[model samples]
Target chain A: MKKAVPLYIGTAALCMVGFAYTLYQIFYVAPLAQAPLYYNQKIFYYHVPCAFMLFAAVITCGIASIKYLRKREERWDDVAFAAAEVAVMFGLIVLVTGVLWAKPAWDKWWVWDARLTSALLLWMTMLAYMLVRKYGGAGAERLAAGLGIFAMINIPLVYASTRLWKTNHPSANTVPSLDSSMRAALWLSVLLFTFFFILLLRLRIDAQRAERRLYRCREMALDAGLFE
Target chain B: MDFLQHVKTLAWKDIRVEFRSREIVYTMTFFAGMVVLLFSFAFLRESSAANGGMITDASLSPGFIWVAVLFSGTLGLSRTFDRERETGTMRGLLLSPMPRAAIFLGKAVGIFVMVLVVQAVVLPLVALFFDAPLFDHPLALLCLTLAGTLGFALVGSVFAAMLLKSGSREVLLPVVLYPILVPLFIAAIKGTATMMSGSMSETWFWIRFLLAYDLIFTVAALWTFEHLVIE
Candidate 1:
């Protein structure tokens, strides 16, 4: 715990600096080429990174879920639970920022476009994962692990079907070549978000571990004739 | 016993019990018919009253038919394990020497047969009520229905078993099942729509998609069913 403090502080500091720089670049350095939608596209830097973070968290949850199922280790379950919580948070940010970007660019807050629709579906799956974890009694962890694994497998199918069905969203190559400075800013934002994600994931897992330990300790005390 | 024999025995047992009781089929078929009736009243009545061609059209019938099947299929899927639980046979089955995958496959096949029976009745009723030209491409429609229903049952059976002990099995099954089956649903809808329109060009793509979905989930459920069912 003592050794982890400086690393946490360093990531927190780096994230703050990177965030400020991203804002500065978005407002001043990047060219406002797409008139009227200039500010809207600015959400892209934050939105895309959040989207990436969401995927990262989900993948982590899936991997951790697999580990939990294999070993039945409470640590893996904690990690899976933490990663799912973070994934839901990042998913919410992606959806909200997606809407913010959409309202300005598409003249509407929502469209059944493939990417957006898949994201909504992904969000719903994560929500369902959490619900099962919460309400699935006795063997809830195992059930949730199964759900996490299923959700991971479904993601690719979701992407494929959405692409096959219809695609009103921008195609893969539609993003024009970014200016060098814009590219640097985007990479920096991604890096910072990655660090932030790791930091939060570690913190959440630690908290959950502590909570489990406390529960076990309480059970032991009750068994030992402590006060009710 | 051989694995195939085990699976068949379990499946046949479920079928015989269901046949003797006649509970699941009657309820599932009735429920499916009611859903179709409700759709006819809501959409068909309103559209015909307004002289709109939407509800009478072939394109919309695919969606209506699948919706009915999906809802009623959920009814049967949730009930798949209830008999085992209520009779305390679930524990006995778990203790049996049969491979867990056989248990899963058997239950899935049982549900698949049940759903097919319900669809057999419901599809004709849909044709009768909505005037859907279901016979235009009968073979294609049959293949699509089989693929779709198989995928649905395979996924639904595992989840139903997992949630058998949960208090809110009915509500939770659909909530968890629908989102995962979205791709399958999309493929089925598009495939059925194309077939009903008498177009074969792009129907194969959706059919292949459904096949792929069934392949992936069937293997996945088989692999995971053991872990999901054991205490």
Candidate 2:
């Protein structure tokens, strides 16, 4: 724990530096490709990375949930819980920034376009998973694990159904070519966000482990008649 | 073979209970009818005050029918496990030497049949009230309804079981079920709308989507039901 403090601080510092660099590139380095949408499109740097991190967290949550269900290990549950929490946070950022981007790009604050709708539903599903974890009784962990897996499986179906229903949102498939500098900045922002996501996940898992340990200690103390 | 037979027996048990008591089917059918009635009042007022055209009713009936089915189907799903929980039969069933997935399949089958029955009643009522031409493509409408109801039952049964032991089962069941069901709803509504418009061309896409959704969630629920049901 003592040795890990410096590593944590190092990662935080590096993330701050990367964030600053990303902002700089977004404002000045990346060419203003789309006219009249120049400054507004800058939200893409942060929004896309947040969206990517959200998906990565969801996948991690699902995999950890499967492991916990199979092994019934507290450690796997902690990972799943942490990933879910992180996923919700990133999902919020994605939605907020998405709206900000949408208002400028589409002249509306919200649209029922496939991508946006699916993203909102995904957020709601994650929120439901969190609610079940917090309020579901007795076997909340197992129930939440099931929900986690279910939500993960539903993501593609959500995307597919939305696309089939309508296609108002911009398609990733038809993205015009980005300038070399813009591509570099986008990749850099993604890498930075990935690093930050990992750091936050580790901290969250550690906190969960400590809380569980404290809970077990309390149980042991009670059994030993230390409190009465 | 043994597993399937177990599923059939368990499903029959539910069917028999429902048939004798007539609680789930009656309530589901009534609730679905009420939903359609309410939607008719709302849509009829809006459309009549706007244009008083039959075309508007025809255009809106598909969505309204699905909405009614979804709400009443949720009511039926909650009742599915409530019966077992109320009678304290869930534990006895779990204690039996059958695989837990069989229990999920049985309950899902029961709910599927119940929802279909409710749909059978509600569809004609919706058509009658809205004066919509829903029977233009009977086979297509039936196929879409079956796929949609099966998908709903598949997901709802697993969630109902998972929440069976929770305190806020009624509230949380729909809270958790509805968002995940967005895809199924979209497919069903689109399919129904296309079918109502008398064009079978685009309806196939939504039907295919519904089939894929039903298949995916059926496998998922079966795989996870055992984990969800264990104490």
Candidate 3:
């Protein structure tokens, strides 16, 4: 715990630095957008990074959930819970930013395109995971673990199924075709978001750890007749 | 050999229990019928008003039919598991000398059949009410519904069992199942819509997707039930 403090602060400091630099590059270095989307297109840099991080968060939650289900360990559940909450934050940003970008780019506030719908459904499942964890009562942990795994498995299927709607959102490889300056800015933004993601995950895991420890203390105190 | 027989017997037990009262089937079909009726009430007039008679858009029937299938599917799934939890029979069934996967498979098979039975009423009703041609490719339609129903049942049975002991099972069941089953619903609806449009190749594509969904989730549900369930 003591050693982790410095690493946490260092990551936070590095992330701040990265964000400051990336924002400068995005605003100043990255060239003006093309005809249709001149100014608002900058949202793509933020939106794409958040979208990528959301995927990372979900996959992390799923892996941690598998471990928790297999071992029934408190630590694994903590990791899974932390990852899920982080996923929700990132997922929200992805959807909102994507929608904001869409209004200017696609001339629609929302599109029923494959990528958008899949992201929407995936975010909803993550929201359900949070709901079940909060309200599922006694066996909430097990139920949540099942949901986390199921959510991960549905990722590919959801994307594939919604593709039938004839997608208009930028394709997956659109990132590669961007101008060199904009692409560099986007990469820097992604790096900054990665740092931020790690900081949030670590903080949440620590909070969950503290919570379970307090719970154990209360149970032990009750057993010892200290409270009664 | 032994496993299949065990699964069959367990499924048979469920069917017999269901046949005795027929409460689940009757109410489920009725609920589905109401959904179909409501669809007609809501959209039939809109379409009729648009063109002044039954020039009902065929592309739209698939969405209505699937809504009914999914809604009634959730209604019956929780009730089916509630029956087990009410009498503590799930525990007994778990305790008996049979594989855990068998119980899961048997229960899924039972619900799969029930949802299919409900869909039987739903399809013709949607067609009759909406005046949409959903039966042009009979074989494709059959395969699509079967595959879609199979995916729905496999996922629904596991979730219904997971939420069995929870207090908010009624609300939580659909809250949990609908999002997870979105892919299945999309594929099924797409398949039906394509069939209505007389597109065999695309309809088969969606059917294949649904079949793959069933295969993956069937394994996932069995694994999850075995590990997640406790007496």
Candidate 4:
């Protein structure tokens, strides 16, 4: 655990640089472009990579869920629960950035377009998973694991709804073609956000594990009549 | 042979119990009916244009109907799972040799059947109250309704199974379910709206969308159901 600290710090440093580059692209080069429409579209570099990180976290939950179900190990459940909480935070970041972008680009604070609504769905699903963990009691680990699995099941439907329906929401076809410089910057943002997501997930899991350890110690002490 | 028998027995047991009480169906129907009534009063003030496609001003008819079903569907989902949890019978079923997905499917099928009946009544009630003339494209309406209901029940069962033993099962299920079901709601509403507005030509397009949605969610629900119910 002591040695692991350095890895996390390194990852954080890398992510901070990526975040800086993402901000630069969105605020700088994006504005210098010939068209104003592309101005807000630059938010996509930050917005989409954050969305991908959220997907990665959710998929991690699914994997942890399967492991928990197969093995009934408390450790797997800890990872699943922790990953889910962080996923929700990243999801909110995505929602906020998208809203910021939408407000300037589309002249509306929000739109029921498929992608936006889908992100909302994912947010709610993550929130529900966290709530189940928080309020559902001792038996909740199994249940939370189950809900994680079910919620992940909804992701693709959320992603594909726009292409399937002819709605006011802009379709994927509307995504602007990216120049070479923009493409390079966007990929770097994705790579950097991925590192940040991993670092946060590890820190959360450590916190959860420590809490569980303390809980078990208290339980065992009570069983031995230590307090009495 | 044993697994088949187990599946049949569990499904039949749920049906028999539901028959004895009718609690789930009654609550879902009344709630669904009342929602349509409330929306009609608030949104349409009078029944003058109720005979035609009148409330076409806003995204009225399908929007209101889908909202009602989504809410009531959650109500139905919790009732089904709470029944198993309260009685402690679900553990016995889980310990049985029957596949877990079978148990999930049993619940899914039961909820779908009950909600379908509710929608059957609710759709006509909307047509009569809002005067939207829904029956003109009965086939398309039926397809969208079935797809939407199945997706709801399928995903809902996975959730119910997930939440059955937990304390906040009732509140937890819908909070998780509604957001996920948005696509289904949109597809069903759009497809149904087109059908009702007599846009029969383009109706095929939206119907396919609903069908695709139904297929995607059904498979996802199936893959995940085992993990949810196995414990």
Candidate 5:
């Protein structure tokens, strides 16, 4: 883990550079969004990728959670916790950017559109997962693992709801018809966000692992009466 | 066969206890009725008094039944395991020969019945108060409520068991339960609304959705029971 510090620094630097390039591309290169949206539409590049990362993070948390429950492994719980925290951050980015773009394009900060509602529902579950971890007391980790599994089962329902109902948000096919330049910027943002998410997840897992080790060692010392 | 008996015996124990006291049944029924009553008070308009205080906000009529169910259902879920906790009977239950899944299913069955009983009174109260014909399509309404209540009970039982030993079970139950149960609520409320609107065919779709939700989570609750409920 110590040897990975330089690698972590290098990845952080790359993410910083990648984010800068993506911002530059968004402003100077990506073509103007259609009539009403204009420059305000630029949030789409960031918002869409963040939404993708949010889903990716949630799936990671779900899978790790299942593994943790099946094996009762602390590392799996660590990974699940890290992924869930990342999911929450990206969930916020998705909602905030989506809301910001809506203000300019849809003239409302919020709409009851199916897609928006779907995103909000998933985010709330993620938030609730964190709450259980924080205040659920002694067996909170196990309780959280159980929630992760249920949240995973709820995913298909969330996904299908948007399709089974009406949606005001741009439909799924909107991505395929994007102009080439905008598509380039969008893909680049997606790529950068993926790398950035993995680095953050890895760093968090390592930090949690370190924290667990310290706790264990302290407990051992207490048992041995090391303070005496 | 023995497993079935185990499940039955466990479920009967809870029913017999609650029925004898009539405490949970009475309190939950009252709470559910109050939910519907308050909703009417909030939404009813005095200007519609010309029609003898007709329900002016009928669009929400379908949701009122479920709102009552969801709220009182949470109340009942919080209390279902209280007796076990209070008497330290959970340890005895755990030590018994009954499989973990049996314990979960048994308790869930009891809670499901409790909710249905509450609904029996709450349903009439909602119809009389909200002025919706909840009983016009009795069979459809029954199927929707069964599926919804079953899903609610199964999920609620698992979490309630997990939080059984926690200090903050009451507050955390809804926070943890509602997000996961939102889909169930939507499907039930929508199905009720569809049935009340005289659309027989559309109501089936929501009924199927609720059943699917119930089926999937039943498996989930059973699977998680052994792992989650162990001391």
Candidate 6:
């Protein structure tokens, strides 16, 4: 087993259990009376958790960005890249699931409400960050780190725009606004998604390191004239 | 005294270079004109009550004008640094003695000035075509424009710097900037629109938002600029 096996196992186990419970809440255990409110669309349990995880991943990206800038460590860049990639994945999930929820709940596939628009903006920024990394070359680490910090700056903007503008977007909970049963279920979902994010990030980081190692090996072999 | 001299020299160099080419300003103004014209035709038809409402309402709703401005502003952004990269001059400037912050700020202020000039021309054209009265509070509107443009230029400059060396400079600049700029545009345009519509009572809040936007991004750009351009 690799050095990351324990973390992988722990996260996979936690996520599996949480995902199972989330499925139960969305499909089986959720009350039919509450269906009108969500209209058998309690899949928002999964959606909202993913949204939170997306935010958490972006924040971590920002932290890693700062670390890279301050320390100039390639590791921090690696971690930042991992977090940003995960944020993009989770952000895409939020967008898709939110659109899914919106179609049934709002009778429209998408609304230009502040929350949705801001979320879309965030998704665009994440995609841009990934692109910057893909093409940035020798300067990729620093360039992507700079963009990661810049992208994180959008989160607060997204939050504030929802408040300042007259959009139909739901205001983020000032405090977790769920009752006991709902809160327990919601927290579990969030925990599970966080674990999933961790697993994905670790896997991404490992792949990146492996890629880096292969490049270094190729460079060494070429220098040794192994091919010739 | 010497630091101020460096700032002035760099600003002048950028402006002078831009003048010699004038392509940046021309492209930006032309694009801004097209956008406003398109929106006018789309939303404000030749004759209708809806047109009348849109004309009167456009300035009142800063969202419309600011968005037009923001989208068009990207034209200036990609060109600002993209020109330098095209000519292979960005690295030469980076090798100069000017502080990176000064380079960042000077380029920003130059672009802000350029964008404001475009807005100055475009806003009146928008008003004339739509029959909207935009000069109701010219001074206050100017203040909002300056503050808003400064913030946009600040953030835009950093992204432009980062994208200058990237493959798809045009595509990447707006992708990184549009979302981060949402709040700045929202607050500034709201302030401008409100002032134009005789709603200056909310001036303080908008001013604060503008100032906050400028401060945060200026500090952020200054802090990270060295990391960005220093290789």
- By lDDT, the best candidate is 3
- Per-prediction count of colliding residue pairs? 0, 0, 0, 1, 0, 1
Candidate 3 runs further than 4 Å off: B46-56
Residue pairs clashing in model 2 are none
Candidate 6 per-residue C-alpha lDDT over A95-205 given as tens digits, one digit per residue, 9 for 90 to 100? 998988887667789877777876777777778788877765557677778878977876776566456666665556722755555666667787778778888988988
TM-score of model 6 relative to the true fold?
Answer: 0.90
The residue pairs found clashing in candidate 1 are: none
lDDT of 4 at B60: 76
Q: For each candidate, report its DockQ versus the true two-chain complex.
A: 0.70, 0.73, 0.85, 0.55, 0.75, 0.51
Runs of candidate 2 with Cα error greater than 4 angstroms are: A173-176, B45-56
Question: How many steric overlaps does candidate 2 have?
Answer: 0
**What lDDT does candidate 2 reach at residue B73?**
91
Per-residue CA lDDT of candidate 3, range B1-231, in tens? Answer: 989988999889888999898999999999999987777667643443645764445557899889998999899998899999999999999999999899988998999889989999999987877778877777898999899998998999889888988888899889889999999998988888888888788988999999999999988887788878756
* Residue B182 of model 1, lDDT score: 90
Quote the positional error of residue B169 for candidate 2 in Å: 1.3
Query: Which segments of candidate 1 are over 4 A away from where they belong?
Result: B45-57
Ranking by DockQ: 3, 5, 2, 1, 4, 6
Clashing pairs in 4: B50-B131
| Residues B147-218, model 5: lDDT tens digits | 889989999999999999888999999999998998888888888888988898989998988888888999
Candidate 1 per-residue lDDT over residues A33-99, each given as its tens digit:
4776876777888988898999899889989988888888999999999999999999999999999
Best by DockQ: 3
Query: Comparing candidate 1 with candidate 4, which one achieves the higher TM-score?
Result: 1
* 3 versus 5: better lDDT goes to: 3
Residue-wise lDDT of candidate 5 within A48-112, one digit each (tens)? 99999988988899899889989999999999999989999999999999999888877899987
Model 6 clashing residue pairs (backbone): A35-A39
Q: What is the TM-score of each candidate against the true structure?
A: 0.95, 0.95, 0.97, 0.86, 0.97, 0.90
